[model samples]
Target: MRPARLSVVTATTVAVAALATVTGCTAKSDSTAGDGAVQVIAKDDACEVSKTEFPSGHVELAVENKGSKVTEVYLLFPDDRIVTERENIGPGTKAKITAEVKAGSYEIACKPGMKGKGIRQKVTVTGGTAAKRSPEMDAAVAAYRTYVQEQADETLPKVKVFTDAVRAGNIEAAKKAYAPSRIGWERTEPVAESFGDIDPKVDTRADGLEAGQKWTGWHRLEKELWQDKKLGADAKTLADELDKDLLDWQKRVGRAEITPTSMANGAKELLDEVASGKVTGEEERYSHTDLVDFKANVEGAEKSFELLKPVAQKNEPALVTELDKQFAALNTLLDKYRDGADSYEFTSYEKVTKAQRKELSDGVNALAEPLSKLAAAVVK
Candidate 1:
């Protein structure tokens, strides 16, 4: 019912297939043409932009991949909350992305191999009206933060259980704890991206990165524990690395800022992610935990929506009513996948039929349409 996030495994498909795009505050599957959108290229491990500077407000950057392999392009804030991204762009294709950026210094990243850090370009925006945020939006951010922190706090112990299993070379125990432990992290992923470095260390997959990028975290352990069924030295090291990073990350939570615009944008991005990764069954391919992340993303979006609801109810009661109905319908749909426990069963990625995927997609899109407009609707 709630949706997903950006990770390497899913992101590759995201670029070439359906990008996580924002339409107002909603997610739009199609490309949006900007009035004066500029062109950039992803070529042989570089992100080359048409210009280095621009006027702020509504800005569009059109990226084309001339590279031989798949690639991704992102407009990143200093904290690494992606302004907009076009992932999975294959050779000879292009992706058009637009964002509302205020005058400031920003970073442009072109992941040439769609792995690791691609080339980065620094750009400056000249002029634009400052975004006005309200207490309603602030409350939404605060609520989401509390939820994220709680998730992380609860997750640390579970992860220790998992890592301890891996450390002790207990593959059976490690496998059992995997998906459930990840749910805590996956739920708050929209906020997690702001942590930048920690995200990759904790979750990158082998196939998710460009050539030669080191894969680590849960998926790395997933391979040894599930695929190899042998937790070796490298596997233990990865588990230990994840152990330290998760603890350090919790310490950084209070320092991050979650604004109304980002929360609104994150809601749409989460659903867009569902369409790209979870529905396609590209994410958690090895672990078959796509459904787990999918549910968490939805829950995260709901937290964002709940915080914004009072504003919506005052401004547009009809829209609020519609959102409530759609969210319930979607959640009802997701609930069918529950494992009789608090978590979803998902069965297996391959077991999911085309009809099933479409059913989920259609439900998510229905909720997404009304969900996307919430931020701007409330702001107005």
Candidate 2:
């Protein structure tokens, strides 16, 4: 068995408030098998079937886990875009993932323990089957892509400003440029997170640095500019490196896909960040700008929700409305600390009372309740 390129991520106790189990935990699907759904059984060693060819259109892959451990299946395109995926398949249960696919060569991967790659099979889809499209799904993906592109566009220039300030030893200007610069990064975090190497450089927390890996990026600059009140030569070089990374990311506009399942999971991931990092004040420990990151996370998650609201409304209208209201309420609650219009300033993290932080935490969990149901409702 070849080692998988992916790492196992475990969710914490905080996630229980929003999700019954964290993402990788076992989840059995109770969905009815559609006519287009293909059943693929997973066992202890290999996938039951492999290297199959199929016609395209509305393609559904029903993956059943007969293995003792939790497993997941991914249908991926050549460019590394995940077209469809079913995760958390416990032993003796099955789940289905449906996607509108086109004529292309794809790969199916089964991951046992949700860790290393179990097995992979190639799939060749011929052009005879017409490509199918869904207006709702298309619109949602387009919106998310546009949002990512816009953020990338904005990030290019902001990063330069921050880097230049650091080079010039302008602590005040660098500090000013830091929080707002992070907004665009945070808003498009789902895509940023896709590139594992870049994400840590863009937003690595100071305390979480691996042994021997030098800490850089926003938090590193945060310490130099705020805590030490000095910007050193090393920090300046890091600033330039960070700027380069952001511009390189800018060039990848429209490269990623924005499926409903991804959006649903992205929203949940953003809130998980809030619960684990923002509310805990661990993300911006040096500068106490956790509120800024919190706002951007909410904005990102809210954008996902807004994009998929139409589809969710069609299936669960009341839940959609309540989700909207909850989101709005959460935004309203966060707005109390807003101190600047164009400046994007907010009350410092330390200044926010424990009660107010609790309110924010409560708001996130509230939104997560209805938001969790969105993927299942829209995927069908």
Candidate 3:
């Protein structure tokens, strides 16, 4: 990952807020016999499935647990069907199962404690007796791999800049860099919260370089010092001691990461409906509710851009570049409908201004263009 270049002009104007709807689904399907072999491993709340492609029918699945904790894995099909399931596969254990499935889409989820959080791998099973790989599938997988690589490339360098700023006692820089660096982690909330204890105020100060400096970012020395609760006696000393706790709380909030999956999922679901033509009823399809959600997604993405502007300008040029494209795509989408018009409930082209409808259609298509490329890569 390379450092993102920060634009000074844009930094000062950035604003942060919750925006966008996350979207996605989980499902599984059967595998064909004698289709070579399929093996999947579950570890660290993720599933490493063998063979991105699957043939329809009864396929054997072998799952192994390498992590220390107990884990459960499920093979899911579309329509909320579970093709196969294995629970409480303890550390160093393995389980094998077989199931018959039809073609369409599927997902493999390895979850622990039924937390509704886990790694999901999308799978596609083709029809027919002979197992064959489609060229389109191959292209989609390649594209998805590229997308993941791009995101990783875009994220790490910015993270390094944020970490470096913290180490250098550059509080303002660190704060600016925190947003995008923490976006993915935030999606996992409680799990991401355990990463560290941070103090925003004292930690943000420039004096952090001094030998006896107050705690700053993640695991600063103060946490160990005050854990015993034997620091001081006088009011001034006790006040200083209490300040650490306060700072710790602030740090937690500052570094929190909210997962974007839900927002993405919501947007995709609505768009899928529009594409399929099932949502044709003007009253139900173009409801004001749909427009509100679309607006919210746009606003959310803007907020994300705002929060990361400072750091993004300086540390992650690629992300900034990609973001600009994303923004343009979204703006184009929003121009399609009246500010508060019920897009879903839109009965005919005449209901809204032609220009507005064209903008909306174009915007949706524009957003979907990049997203489809990106999605094709990930939702294999």
Error (Å) of candidate 1 at residue 182 is 0.8
Rank candidates, lDDT, best first: 2, 1, 3
Candidate 3 residue spans exceeding 4 A from truth: 1-35, 130-380
In model 2, which regions exceed 4 Å deviation?
A: 1-133, 341-343
lDDT string, candidate 3, 63-174, tens digits: 7787677676666654333455445567898765444456777666666433333455666677776322244434433433343234434545555665555455555564
Cα lDDT of candidate 2 equals 0.71
Clashes per candidate, residues 3 or more apart or on different chains: 12, 0, 47
Ranking by TM-score: 1, 2, 3
Q: How accurate is candidate 3 locally (lDDT)?
A: 0.41
Q: Output the worst ten-in-a-row residue range by lDDT, candidate 1.
A: 16-25
Poorly placed runs, candidate 1 (over 4 Å):
1-73, 78-103, 108-122, 126-130, 314-318, 344-346
